[model samples]
Target: MADYTPNETGSQLFAEKMWLQGALITAVGYGAVLTLYVLAFYLLLSRLDRWNRQAHAIFLVYITVQFILATLFQASSARFTQLAFINNRDYPGGPGAYELAFFYIPVDMLGNIVYVLSNWFSDALLLWRCAVIYSTCRFPLWVIMGFPAVVMMGSVGSGIMYLLQVSTTSPFLPSSANFTIIDSSISLALNLMLTIMIVGRLVVYRFRLKTNFGLSVSQRDYTSVMAMLVESAGLYAAFSLFFIVPFALGSSVENIAFQALSQVQVIAPFLIIVRVSQGKAWSTSTALEITSASEGLGTLKDKVPMAQIQFACASGDDTSMPNAISHHPSVPNSDTTLTTEVV
Candidate 1:
């Protein structure tokens, strides 16, 4: 909001160092979490060998890219801080204005791009699962996803505009801040909507299963899966809010929270992979069984109740039914994707 000045008070330099310290702490935390993510990815591959390997691989790519973006941010921050402190007096001129301007690092542009891309990638992944869940129920896909999709585009546009403004301006502009604030707000809204819509579909689906099949498996197990999904989304949304609230309110924690936000973007999906692989949530085997059972019920809706259909199809022991199912046909790839939401 003001011109770049090298006349920094001791307190201001200390504050900047403190902000960078918080960012360093967040970076370390993310490093530990990224290790967990890699381990989880391996376990997922081993456990879901029979499932869609391509889809899982793609998801891993998203996480890896997010991690790479964070690493870039950390490197940029280190360079920026070094120029600010260690080389503060090395400029041949009286003082270095670019060095004093913390936001002018070229890496910052790349980092911002990465941050925005990672946020959207995670959001799109969740929305894809939502589409799969609702599609089975004959819900209109475009209608359900249309608004958030538009907002996502708006976020990207805003981010690009903000970067352009930052590149041209001597100091931070209110307009640039507005652009980022809008992007963060939209991102928060997208996450909240995804969490609510997905959790709602899951609860409804679980109820239908219980009503039709009558708790053959423990309700607790089923609930635990739903809870895990909800909690992961909730945690991500919570941090999105944490970053935005301080930022919007002009609170002191904004920088620290923003740094942490980058890592949480990776954490939410990685947690899903870990839970699924551990069988604390739905695994590939469980996902397949549910799909087969649901399809069998759809085909024999008039002849047998859902419970009987599941017994005939899922049990694998009915001699009277072909392959223990009255209507045992190969499930199409589209039909096989019902459990994509759980992960």
Candidate 2:
């Protein structure tokens, strides 16, 4: 047992309390994200026809793997909490110090590994989405993705260092702390870049639509603020910023953020998959259709008989309009309903 001043004992007690609070928050968040995961998974399986089987299979596998990782992480965290507060409460320097000292233990190490894996998978998904959204851009895919890919590799390297150091030393030690900060900074930077790219692409598309067609209700469905946030995984990025800042500062607030981060990571990509399954997510065909319509607006109006035009803008497995065009309120009501091919 090591000698501790009164202040040190008080600080350890506070840290233990914070850890318990963080664990509660993690439990709640895990339940909510699990619900979302299930819903997204079911929707994808049910709507296999929306996308190619290969794509659907890939998404299914990705989410399944993520789920497994998250589950293991949560289990490890719970086990550690049990050991720290219940099993080892009387450990020298209190439960909090016990947690720090025993971080290299198998349970805590498992949690750390899975946590890093979750970040990697989540970042990779965001990068892939950015690439898909910009696939039609003048720049080559490699050009746009190359830098972020390199940064991701750096994040991986730093993560490995952090893990290795934590396996032999306390994470609060300077050696492990440095790697932790580096890994987190790199991951955050990558996430922000990918988010900006995706949202920027959608914003440009929205502007083009508004400029070409004036204002239409259907256009909002595709490029609205809510759509942009969801598709870009902006929520995750925002939460990450909230967490990373405090974590880097060595604030206790990081405990809460850290606990919830794994769940949020899963939730972010699950939301995207839900949108894709519902045919509301932007796809290559959707982009091409919008571009064709915008470029040939006048021609379409002149060539197609107005009386023959009927807008079918319903969402969910509807082939009436390309994905993302939910409804068009711009068309004037007429006594005669007609059918015309969408441009």
Identify the leading candidate in terms of lDDT: 2
How well does candidate 2 score on lDDT at residue 305? 55
lDDT of 1 at 246: 76
Question: What TM value does model 2 have?
Answer: 0.84
- Clashing pairs counted in every model: 0, 0
Query: lDDT per model, in order?
Result: 0.62, 0.78
Q: Estimate each model's TM-score.
A: 0.68, 0.84
- lDDT agreement of model 2 with the native: 0.78
Off by over 4 Å in 1: 1-18, 47-49, 89-100, 170-173, 207-222, 225-232, 275-343
* lDDT, residue 208, model 2: 79
